[model samples]
Structure formats: structure tokens, C-alpha cells
Target: MGVPTLVCAPHRLLRRIEAGYLDNPYHNAVHAADVLQTLHVIVHGARLHVHYLDPLGLLAAYLAANHHCAAAFELLTRHTELDVLEPLSTADKAALRKLVIELVLATDMKQHFSTLTHFNTVHQLASTKSFAAAGSSGEGLLKSAPGGRLANVQQEFKEALYADGGPDGAAFASGGPDAAAAAPAPLDDSERLLSLQVALKVADLGHLAEQMEVHKRWLAALEAEFFLQGDLERQMGLPISPLFDREKQGVSKSQVGFFEFVALPLANALSSAFPGAQPLMECLTSNYRHWRRAEREAAAAAAQQQASAAAATAAIN
Candidate 1:
């Protein structure tokens, strides 16, 4: 648990990171801060600190949240004053840099499904191992859990799902399809970087797990950014990306699709691995429901308007 001391005060480095981000509506400094805070919560709540990640890995995870892209890493490298890894051994420094880069890269939407798949594999394997070792018993399976309280909760979670033939229970019991794929590179006691990578990805999309009003605010900012991109594309005589054409895309439908395909699955995978983080899935579910309802209402209104137009045309004839 020997995290290195920073060359300068932590706030000094944080200020530089904050200043490096541009004024993009959804990708600015505030978004970085939100990801950092969310990552911190996920690590602690999931007990990653207790059982999986060492101090260096924990530091890397947090750093990846701020330096979430190659550009942000370049910003860090450009300034000697912000060398948080200045005090580490050469090997430790290399390891930390590699980890931070990989974690940041995983935040790319292109890698979204692949990253989620890997985490699911890890969780399934771990669940199978835990259950096997505990054989015909569920007690003390969560030794690394903070206290008896959470251990009990973990046990209850196990019993409710695995004992009741739940869908998740079947997946864990059978190790799913990724179990063989995960065997070659199983997790060790020292570092669970894969899990941390999943945590970073989830934190990047963390706004989806916020309260309804907060979630709407983030969606508004994101859509505004998308619309700006579409505007630039149109000006340059280029093709606009899907859902970025604000004039054609209905916000309700776009959000419903995004939540279903991207947000909810990722959040559910994380929560499945760490029951303590289940509240995240709950928030996401609520937000999803809101979007679905909005989608329905929008469709109904459109249909009504079309019908009214037809009636008026017939009257004119």
C-alpha cells in the first residue's frame, strides 16, 4: 500500500489537469471531475481496494479517470511540475504508465462491448471459484468484505440468485461462454487491472446512473455537443453521424436506444460483479424507465398530429 508521494502538492497537479480540458459541453473539466469521483466510489463500494487492487493500481485507476485520453496523457507529460509518478521506482513508473494508458483507452466507445465482455468473464470465473471453494456452504465466502454486515449481504445475494434459478445464477453456475477464454489469463491476488478497467469505463458513462434530473442535464449537454458536431459536418459538406442530426433525431428515441444498448448493460455487468454497487443499476433502471415513458408519449403525440392533419385534409376536399 505504498502509493508514491507527488513531486508537488496534489491540488497543483489537479489544477493543471482541470485547465487542460477544453470547453466542450460534455467532455470538459467538470466531466473529468465527475468521472474521478465516480471511480473513487466504485472502487471503495465494490471492495476492489480490499481484495483486488494494490495501492499502485488504485493510484493508476484514479489517474486514468483524469487522464482519460492520449491528449490528457500528453498534457501530463508536457509539464514536469505535474509528475505525480516522479518518486516511483523505474519499474513501478513503467507499470503505472502502461496501466493508465490501457485504462484510458478502454474508455473509448469503440472498445465498450469488448471491455464489458472481459469484465463479465472475470466476474463469472471468480464467482465459480468462490462457490466451489465454499462447497455446500455460503458462509465466509466474502472474507474480504468490509465487515460481517456486507458479508451477510453478499451471502444473501448469493442465495437469492443462485438458489432461486435466476438468470444470473445460471450464467455464474455455468461460467458462461467466456470462462474458457478467461482461463489463460486469470486474475491473481496482486492486481486485478481488468476489473479496474471496467470500473473506469463505467465511471466514464457514470451520468447514466445519476438521478433523473441530473441524468437529463447530462443528456442535454451531450446532445448539444453532438448537434454542434453535426452542424460542423453539414457546413463542410460531410455526412453527419447517426443520432447527431438534431433536426431528424428525436431526443426521446435516441436516449431510449442509448440507454438500452450502451448504458444499462455496462452498469448491470459492474453491479453483478459488485453487489455493493447495485444502487448504480437501480438508478440506471429508473432513468431508463423515464426515457421509455418519454419515448411512448412522443410517439403518441406524433401519431395524433398526423391523424389531425388527415382529418383536416378530408374536410378541405
Candidate 2:
């Protein structure tokens, strides 16, 4: 909330970040800004400032929102343009850089399951601590009940990060498989940082929280990106990713499954943690229904086309 002033050098940095972003339909500077705005809405709607986050935490969230894709771009091109952060004190700049990198790297799709697992574990610990505190007072419950459990959960998260080969398991942070291995452990409040990582992730997919038209546009852009990748893979003689092979993948059906398997669960988890964020879950539900209808229509049209072709062949025969 108050951290915007602290950063104070965003325009130059944003321009640099924009310059480095891929020229894709999505995952560009515009998309980054969109996600940043969505993160603001989520933070406000969830009353994160009032409940879960301090000023520093909010700052980290905002930084993560803005720079979520910067690491990828940097890694890909070996860009050092993030020097716009130089306006801050040396220590502050370094901290912000590390935090932004960690948060951004956590957005890698490959890390999705492990990130969610860590978030869920932290969430459970928070719930247990809250319940224990409710029953007693003055840290007594924290000390007697969930203290050991909290330590264990934190350790597990740390171990998961190491297993992924980074302080933040930011496997893609430096474009190297093991670049993050030498990075120092995260310095912020571990629980708060983990939650913010998850929040930034949800915000990155915040198109699912938009209205149907907006959501469809984003989906189309993403599909275009996927198809582009598939085209490249074909040209390079590499196996194409599922749903990226535009010739065979039905966008509607794939989207339906994506929502059912990925988007909905993420929305449900966020809404559970921050009740005020239920609007996101509602929007996700609406989007899922729209996709399901599209999927059914697509299936029917394909079936009809097949039937008509078969009939014509029989008549000719």
C-alpha cells in the first residue's frame, strides 16, 4: 500500500521491463500491467492490509505483481535492464530484487503443484494457529498446540524449495536449471512471503476473474501463444505440448478442462483463505460454464461434420 512511494522509480523500470517482454499476444508488458491492476483489486478486496499483510508484505506483493514475468524475460535474453531499481538503497534494492525474482519464478507452471502444496500447508498452519489462539490467549496456544506443527510445516516448505533447487524453487529465475541453488534463503516473513507468492500467482491468472468477454479474449490470446509454440515445436522436430497442437486440440474442450482442474481449485483455495475474495470464485464459475457450453457445441459440430462426411462417402460408394 505505502510501498509505491518507496519504489518511486517505476516508470523507467516499467519501460525496461516492457522492452524485455516477449512480443507475444499475451505475457507482454500490457498483460503484466493488467495483472498488476488485478493484484491491486485482489489486495483491496481481500483487505490484505487489514488482515494478513504488513506494509512490507504489501510492498512485496505489489513488486511481485509488476515483475512476475521479468525474470523469464531476463533469463531468456540475459538482460540487465532491471537496473532501474538502482534508485533504492543498495540493501533495499537487493532485497526487492530477490523478492521479485522469487515471486515471479514461482509463477512457472512447472512449479504449480509444489507451490500450491506449500501454500496449502501454510494455510493449514494459519488456521490451526488461529483456532488455538481463539481458545486461549497470549501466545499460550501458539506455544503449546501448533508451535511444533508450524515449525514442521515451515521446514517442509524450505525443503521443498531446496528440492526444486532454489531458495524459492525458482528454477526458471536465471534461465539455468540450477542458477537459484546459490541464492540465499528468503529473508522476509516466510509465511507471509509464501502467501504473497500464491496471491501473485492467482493474480497472474486474474483473467478468470474478469467477465466472459474479457476472459475469452485472454483465453484466445493464450491459445494463440500456445499455437505459436506448437508451430515452433513442429518446425524444430520436437514433440508438441498437449493442447498446443492447434490442428488437433479443441480450444473449448481444453479450456473447460483447465478451469475444472486448475482454475476452479485455485479460486476455491484463495476464496477459502480470504472470504472477501469470493467474487473471484464466482467469476471462475461463470467462466467455466461458458467454456463448458462452448465445449459441448464444438463436440456436436465435429460429430455432425463426421456424420455428413460418412454419409456422402456411402452415397458415392
Candidate 3:
């Protein structure tokens, strides 16, 4: 944790970042701060700190948390007075920038499934290797006490995630007796970076795991933002995106869909890897239940209104 002092004051840098965010109901400065705090909780509460991530990796994760957009990076680089990373060596600075950019880009929903798949694969491979090393098969391990098997796999997964080299590092280093001729060992940074990406993605959607009231507030803000965008598109004679047209989208029903299709899967995967993060999963589950109930109530109310309208028409007839 021996990260060097920043060239600029932390408060000043934060102020600049906040200013750069748009004045949207959602996806604004407050959302960025929320993500930063959520990522911090995941890193520390999930025991990722005990892993092999160096200060640079941690720095990248924090920076990427607030700077998920390309424009945010431009803002940091454009203003010399706000260049908090100016104190680092050239190589370190470049490496940090690259990692931050990758992590930020990884937050895009387009990468969601692939990123989750990669994370699952990493842990799966680690568990398989661990089982092999113990001279046992995964099926045999599964037959053992659930608690014992989970603990063993969790420990091995943590080690694999933090390993400084790939699982095939030995093969990469030994080129058939010509060690020097072997390809250079792959960087373990990929593993660490993937973990950071997962943390950021989870944090980007952190509001979904908040208590019901807080989650409701965030959902309202997000819907407001989407409706605003839809309004703009309408004014411009452009097509409104799905879930953006306020008139057509049912808020509670949409929330239920999002929780089922997007939020739960990622949160569940993370909790599976780090049991310490089960609270996030638990919150999400409770919130999902709330939305499902809300959706049902809304549907019932609509049906009642329709029935009342039909009764009134029949009376007039």
C-alpha cells in the first residue's frame, strides 16, 4: 500500500472529476462516487487486498471506478493542474493508464457476458487444478462435506486469482530444455485486472444491492434519466431506445427484468467466488423480490381499472 503521494491535492482532483460529470438524474458525479465507494467495499470486504495486487493495480482500480468514460480520462490528461498521476515514472504511468482504460472499457454492457464468462472460467480452472493436485477428482470433492469442499476451492481460487503468472507459467518458462528460448512468462496482471473489472462492473450496478428504499430511489433516478433521453430523441425525430420511452415502459416490471437478466447473474457469480460478498447477493435478492411484488400489484391495478371502464361503458349502453 506504499502508493506515492499525488502531485495534486486529492480534494482538488475529486472536485474536478465531479465537475466533469453531466447533470443527469443518473450517471452523474454522485453515481461515480457511489461506484468508488462500492469498489472499495468489494476490494476490502471481499479480502481482495490479501491477494497479490500491488499498489499500482489498486490505484488503477480506484481511478477506473470514477473514470469509466473516455472523456473522464481526457479530462484528467488535459489539465496539468489536475494530473494526479504526474508523479509516477513514465513506464509506471503508462502502465497505469493502460490498465485504467481497460478496466473502464470493461464496464461497458457489451462486454458483460464475456467478462463474466472469463471470470467463471478462471475459477473453474483453478478448482480443477487444485483437485488434481490433491489426487482427487472434482466429483469426489463434490461428494465430500459441502463446507470443506467450498473452503478448499475458495482458498485455491483466491491464490489463482492473485498468481503472478498464468497457470501454465512453468511450460512457458521451459522450452524443451532451452529455457532461455522459451516465450516469456505471461503477465499475471491479466488475472488481477479481471478481478478489478468485476469489482467495477458490480459497483457500477451497486444501487441494485442497496436496501429497498435506496434501491427504489436509484431506480427512479435512472428511469428519469432514460425518459429524458427519450424526450430528447423524440424532439429530434429519432427512434426512442427500448426501456427509455417512459409512456411505454412499466417501471416496476422493468426493474424486475433488469434484476433477473442483468444484476443477479453478476452479483451471484461474484458471491460464489468471494463468500464475503454474500451480503450484496442477499440485498439483490430482497430487492428483486420487492420489484416482483410491485410489478404484480401494478398489473392488478391496471386490470381493475380496465374492468371499471368496461362496466361504465356497459351501463351507458
User: What Cα-based lDDT does every candidate model obtain?
Assistant: 0.65, 0.60, 0.67
User: Candidate 1's residue-wise lDDT over 113-205, tens digit each?
Assistant: 777766655554556755454444323323322221333445554453233222311122122232222112236732267777777888888
Query: Which sections of candidate 1 miss by over 4 Å?
Result: 67-78, 128-186, 189-191, 250-252, 315-317
Per-residue lDDT over 213-266 for candidate 3, one digit per residue giving the tens place of the 0 to 100 score: 676788899889989989999999999988888789645447777776677667
- TM-score, candidate number 3: 0.75
Candidate 2 lDDT score at position 197: 72
Better of 2 and 3 by lDDT: 3
TM-score for each predicted model, relative to the true structure: 0.76, 0.68, 0.75
RMSD of each: 9.6, 12.9, 12.1
Error of 2 at 90 (Å): 4.1
At residue 309, what lDDT does model 3 achieve?
Answer: 100
Alpha-carbon runs more than 4 Å astray in model 2 = 1-9, 51-90, 129-188, 297-317
Choose the strongest candidate by lDDT.
Answer: 3
Q: How much is 246 displaced in model 3, in angstroms?
A: 2.1
Candidate 1 RMSD to the real structure: 9.6
By TM-score, the best candidate is 1
